[model samples]
Target: MTLNWDNCPAVSRSSDVMSGAVVFAGTRVPVSALFENIEGGATIDDFLSWFEGVTKEQVNEVLEFATSSLAPA
Candidate 1:
């Protein structure tokens, strides 16, 4: 199921940004990048080191949002 990212404050989408792909707030880094990097054997620290604008708290919030989405509720 496609997630409703609107409730996640760590991210935003705008026609003016990356063609409206959902990205971390205040940064052009797509949220998908987080998953991709992790899938590619990269740690969160590695991602944070590579992407300067995104913060650990933002990443945590996004993760929390995704995890909550998958809950049995």
Candidate 2:
């Protein structure tokens, strides 16, 4: 499986946005925030509720991309 960032359409990074942090498309929410919240015991639903604009589909695509990238090649 290819591990290119293009696989995740909902995630992007631009020098003009949050200092080029990988953030959700069209939003300033950094992707790390999701992982940090989850690592702290926050559920996916809780994340969605707290952070608007990020759709479930976007999260699913990002997670799927991560899983595939981590899988043994």
TM-scores, all models, native as reference: 0.96, 0.88
Model 2, span 6-62: residue lDDT tens: 658989988999998888888888888888998999999999999989988888878
Cα deviation of 37 in candidate 1 (Å)? Answer: 0.5
Candidate 2, which segments miss by more than 4 Å at Cα? 1-4
Candidate 2: count the clashes.
0
Q: Which residue pairs in model 2 clash with each other?
A: none
Task: Give residue 28's error in model 2 in angstroms.
Answer: 0.6
